[model samples]
Target: MASSTVNRWLRPEVYPLFAAVGVAVGICGFQLVRNICTNPEVRVTKENRAAGVLDNFDEGEKYSQHFVRRFVRNKSPEIMPSINSFFSDPKL
Candidate 1:
């Protein structure tokens, strides 16, 4: 009975569902870890827990310097330039 169930789950039609679930789980896990490691509100040490308002501000400033934020901040607001250009062309 267990073997039949496993075979059913292993079918090719189920592969895309598995891949989508795996990718969603992986992204959620990565973001959770990144927030735990980088977010200023997640203080782990006693010293960090005792940090003052000024220290919180400094930590927030440092947090804003995370590479992903910098890269996104510099990017153009348009997300799909090619599709936009194709649609926007007057000759179309």
Candidate 2:
């Protein structure tokens, strides 16, 4: 009686576990084939390679330099006498 009960519990669960493992392996194999067929250089060329052409090269560095110049120019009090007047000692 106990053996029959053990067999009943084991028989129903085995096929589901096998099916789940088979599905997981099939998905991994499909993704592996997909990645192998897609070339990295082709993908990069399709997206960002055009933006990295000569016209855009060093753009970020140039913009950074422009930003530094603007920031330094704005830092001096002479750029706006009104700003100094607003904060200057009221007693004077």
Candidate 3:
């Protein structure tokens, strides 16, 4: 009886969860792209890549991104704060 109940509702009920998850993901992705586009300090251009930090990141701006690749790779939140602190340190 329990198995039959699960089989009946599982397909229909599970879809709302999928839709909720999709909407959540789409909103988050949009926000990220929006922020990146607005920030002039982290401008994305072929010339910037060729020149490295000399041309852009070290323009004495706060929140300058030098270690973006490393920052994104560390997914753990507990470890993420440490990554921020390490990167923010003037010693680096």
The best candidate in terms of TM-score: 1
Q: Give per-residue CA lDDT, model 3, range 5-71, as digits (tens).
A: 8887679778899899899999999768856764555558788657655544444343444366457
**Candidate 1's C-alpha lDDT?**
0.85
90 Cα displacement, candidate 1 (Å): 2.5
Per-residue lDDT of 1-92 in model 1, one digit per residue for the tens? Answer: 99999998999999999999999999999989978888878866889778854456877888778778887897777989889978998883
How large is the C-alpha RMSD of every model relative to the true structure? 2.6, 19.1, 12.7
lDDT for 22 (candidate 3): 91
Order the candidates by lDDT, highest first. Answer: 1, 3, 2
Pitting candidate 1 against candidate 2, the one with the higher lDDT is 1
Error of 2 at 29 (Å): 0.3
Pairs that collide in candidate 3 are none
What TM value does model 3 have?
0.37
